[model samples]
Target: MVVFFFVVGLEVRQEFAHGALRDSSRARLAAIAGVAGVAVPALVYVLVVGASGGEGLRGWGAVVGTDTAFMLGALAIVGPRLSGQLRVFLLTLTVVDDFLAVSIIGVFYSDEIRPVPLLVALGCLVALWLVGRSRQWSAAPYVGIVIVLWLATLSSGIHASLTGMIAGLLIPAYPTQRHKVVAARQLFRDFWQSPSASSARAVGRGLSKGVSVNERLHEYLRLPTALLVVPIFALANAGVDLGGGVVADSLGSPVTWGLIAGLVLGKLLGIGIATLLAVRMGAGRLPEGVGMGSVFGGAALSGIGFTVSLLVISLAFDSSSDLGRQATLGVLVAMVLATVLGWSIFKVAARRWGEETADLPMTLDSPVDPEVDHIRGPEDARLTLVEFVDFECEYCAHATGSWEDLHGRFGDDLRYVVRHLPHHPHGPLAARAAEAAAKQGMFWPWLDFVFTRQHALEREDLIGYAAELGLDVEAFIEDLDSDEVAARVQRDIASAEASGAKMTPTFFVDGCRMVGSYDARPLTEMLESSRRGGRTQAAKA
Candidate 1:
């Protein structure tokens, strides 16, 4: 469990560094929704079980988590029809929910607090942080330290699994040094070009330093944790006996019904209603390609509280007691109902909205070609916003407002370029249409048109839009399938792949890659920080 949670921590770190949560503005909605989701379920548990006035009411935390593993596995059943935005939302929410659950356990469920061992654990964490900062290259030291930390934490009355989270967060999330990475790459190339054991060893060490520790751990542990550790955990914890008339008796108990209500109805209402309210109240907008129905379905899936719920049950009730058995039954029923309900809703949503071809996840080393790309600001600008976007993607459309604000505020200080990564079926056509319009010197306006009416970017619609823009319709139609235009869009796709973009509107500010936040203030702040860094480096030079 400790190893599993450590891996979870690693995943969270990676997400914050390079994935959807990098954009805090967009991530805020999901965080808020997660809070509401947890809050509602807890409230339901308290209300329903507390009304009956028994020890069974203590397991409120049981309804708070969506099994990260199960939720995703169920999501996979929906296949390519699942939008990237929904994926981001659910992933973000689950991670946050887990963190909250852990906090609750530490605060509310611990047996007895031990200050001495806890302080030792804290000291170990501090030492680990210090060692990591000083560039410790070997994993052996970390392994030994981790064992000691686990023992300390275990004896300290905190859940021992928390060491995983501590270790994962402490692991470096960035490369050691750019110069070392460059030198290591060169050496690795040297060894590959002319092989030898000595050079091979050097290259290995160099490559190790080139990647962050968290990333290495994540790569090493992801499969084992998912395939082996989590399953074993489920097998041990998920077995609940429904025989001996226990089911019938549990049916009448508030504890059993409360778990069902909290896990099924409370989670759905909390996440779904909170998201809807957030968007409607202008606190935040929903992610593109995600509709209310999809959000509701995803929220339903969030109710599938399996492993974590079981943990809470064990903590809240004596395992051999009637209350414990009843709560156990409730968790099982809730899991079954939530799975069925979520799957049914998502299947309906998939049919209504249609599946979009998802973008392949790529690395961040993709080449940028500002020279051949469409530019919207001065060439000599200090900050550049390189956006890899799908014309029909609603998130991209939402970002247009931010881009406009950026352009208005920064003017020539910021250079903007749009790159096409058409993953959807209609996406290639839309990209070519925009390219065709670019030939007619109406690329920006045509882009505005396509984004404004993103759902109507088909072949016929593209031609109509071109004609509406007063372009030579014949030339525009011919250019739509032109080899040159097709190649250009493909080039952008290639660049996008190289850059590790798995979703629309992947933005890069001064070569720093970020995904999905369209808030003007943060965008501006990032731009300013980049500009300052550049100026500082120039002055030093």
Candidate 2:
């Protein structure tokens, strides 16, 4: 009970602080996608079970599960062939999908309620909160208290594990004093002056000294829950015994059929319909170099229901019943099938799209644009560093400082070029904001803002940051809404593909690609080597 509550609390905090639900649109879309994915499968399961007169009809809801880890892992294996935008889209969709699945279990699957036990559960929660408030209790006492809460909740006919989620939300998770101080300082500079400024400064100072503490914590607490607890739960619960009649029964049963149909058929339909509607309505466009087929394929993969399905089944059915067994089998089979189909479709679709052609050798006789010439120089003192980066990529945000360092060190001698490779669907807006900042000659500052708040990079946040930077917010928004920005982003993506810069934060010094993260030492080595080579070539000439 303790662990589960802890995890749940953490997740709630994190979602508010950094996870997908922070973005209203992304969250809404994810909710929609998740609902369609779950509802279709569930409906199918119930119908099939009812038709066959099978026993697991009550457990139909268990069929709508999504294995984000497995799906993302599979996408990773598929490599750069899959568009970055699609990957981000899948991630956002899955996070919300998980949340919805959990809610369904909590609301619908609880046993018959007795008011006495429920009241006791609330009392226990209050006690636990008071204990947590002290911040002095050892982990042992908390664990024991949690166990008690779980038992109480279990006896109360409420799902016992829900105690974990409830407990997790009630706990406090605040950022360090240093971060608070930094935030205060930034806010003060951006917003207030005079008496307000003085007050803000005082608050900042207090935060710096770790003297003042805010009772309400910022939302990043969910990271621990999602990263730690969710995975553990998955590992513990997902190992089903596939031997004997279990396999046959799962295939033959309505529960299995419904799950399969919902996942395989519903996911694609929902995502496809939504995306098509968005595009048709002029709300969004297909990502550059990404086809409808690949998008559909990725959506199909969204049907991979492993972790949530198992959790739901556990909650909804008694262990001794045939319903539980059927639910388990259905989940496993549907997940396996979804994975295979999605992967195959993506692989074939990506191959058909052809390798990114930007990096290929070009004939010397090819005409060069004057603007391209203006940006290029052959001098050894001048360094041309091109970055293929996604605005929504966390890793890219992390590496933003490294680029800043290079800029500070090299100044005018370095020509840093940014090319868009928006990895997630939300990235394009961020990319547009950066471009808008570029129009106002504040691109770097805007870049800093977006990267620092990457976890909170919603469209409104992007626009708000632009406003904070003193850019014309309306114009910036209009530009983002324009196809011109998207075109520029696409050109950059094609250029990146040509240069073999497949991942975000990919750096090319001259023409040599640098993949993944690197500190000052390696960066310096690469730069120096490039300089030496350029000098040697000059000497030969």
Candidate 3:
């Protein structure tokens, strides 16, 4: 159970770091919707079970959260085009709302409080927080503090799983570091030449340091936790017996019906209305590709309050007690109904609004120019991929490795374009340097060189690198500092902002912006889906 929650924590941490939550505008919209999602569910739970008195109201927190794993898995199955924005909203809401639900319930419902252990746990949390803020290289400190924190929390009256989640949250998340990749590969080369124990250990150490610890643990534990721990936990908790007429008794109980109403109907109303209200009131705009119909469909699916609901049930009532059993039945029923409701809403949305799953603002602000932009593959290709990048950005560097294969998949049918987005302090210099290389007809080669050697970006280094690229050094220097080159970089920056690109390596597949994972599989899927859509439109014409 602790392991499952830890994985959940890692997921939320990643989202905040590099995923959709990083965009404040996008996140704020989801956050506003999330607030209403929580409130309305509780309000519904109270209304349905209020007749049962104060004890029943305590179960309100149980309805406020949903199962993240189930919610996302179901979303993948839905597979609607241009629905990445919906993914972001649900992810932000679930992660934030779950934490609030658990923390609040833990505070309000625990039987006995242990201040000493809690204070010790608090100290560890503060330490972990500090470590996350620093540019720490090793995972040793994180692992050590988290273990101690877990033990202290176990002894405390507070739920220990909450500590696991907090520890995961406190760990920093970042995209792959290019320098570290190079260093790790070099270490492996050293080991290959001398296969001794010392060198082997060095290789292991290097590999661990190649990526941020937050990502390392998440990748390592995701499989086992998902396949084993979460499933086993679910089976253990969710497997209920009704052979002894317990179902008959539960049907008569307000707790059972209250949970159902709160999860299914309440979630749909709360999320859908809240998002609409927020957008209408000018608090935030919905993502472009997303529609209200899709939002409602997504909201309906948010009612699968599995793990947290079970945890809350235990916290609020004795597991063997009648109210607890009744609450359990309600949760199970809501899961079934939510799935049905989601499917129904999505179907209706598809028919009425031409919206299948979700939304995102994806149209490229500037059209591709074969003569002006650096391109790989045919300009008249059916698929267009545009990347907004800064040469100094490591994430952009990391992404270059995938482009060759991506272009290979579509051959002349896809054109890959790279545009400048000077999103960093050193980005402008790198862009100007690349523009200088363009003057020597070596723009593409210069990009490959500067990305690997981003650490050396001074004027002297740029000139030196330009010479290595077989360019006129003086001409390169002249162009590097030219007002014309600066203007070219500035133009790209303006286009990137106008296109709503908030980070380097933002991708547009067929003019629709792709968010979240930019790996080959997801990128390929988006490209293919868009290609098919384009063909269908053309055929209809």
Q: TM-score winner among the candidates? A: 3
Over the stretch 1-541, how does candidate 2's per-residue lDDT look in tens digits? 2343445445554555555456666566555665666666666666666776635666766656566666777666653442555665666665555556665666788889877888888888887678768752234455566667777887788776556666655554443344445566566665455557667766655443332111232123345545776788767766656666777876777666766776676777766677666656654554344556666677777777676677777776753346667666666776777778776776666577653221222211112233432132233436666566777664452443676667566767766656677777778777777776676667667766677776677878887888777888888888877887677677766676665555576766665665334554556566666667753332112
What's the C-alpha lDDT at position 414 in model 1?
Answer: 84
- The number of the candidate with the highest lDDT is 3
1-541: candidate 3 lDDT, tens digit per residue: 6677777788888988888787787778888878788899999999999987867777888898888888877776663654566776778878777777666665776657799999999999999989888867688898899889988887888877777888888888887776788788899999999889999999898888778889988888899987898788777777667767779989998889999999999999998998888888888777656788888888998999998788788878865677788898999999989988887888888999888546534557778877678887777888888888877776672345777768678888888888998867788888899998898888888877787787777778888898788999888888888999999888888778777686878888876777668777777877887788853332112
**lDDT (Cα) of model 1:** 0.78
For candidate 1, the per-residue lDDT at 245 reads 80
Q: Backbone clashes in each candidate structure, one number apiece?
A: 2, 15, 4
Clashing pairs in 1: 362-500, 363-500
Model 3: residue 205 alpha-carbon error in angstroms: 1.1
Model 3 residue 376 CA deviation in Å: 5.9
| Residue-wise C-alpha lDDT for candidate 1, range 212-256, written one tens digit per residue | 777887888889988998889778766667788888889899988
Error of 1 at 337 (Å): 1.1
Q: State how far residue 94 of model 3 sits from its true place (Å).
A: 0.9
Candidate 1 Cα outliers beyond 4 Å, as residue runs: 78-80, 135-137, 175-182, 348-541
RMSD of each: 16.0, 11.2, 5.4
Candidate 2: global Cα-lDDT? 0.61
lDDT of each: 0.78, 0.61, 0.81
Model 3 / residue 56 / CA error / Å: 2.8
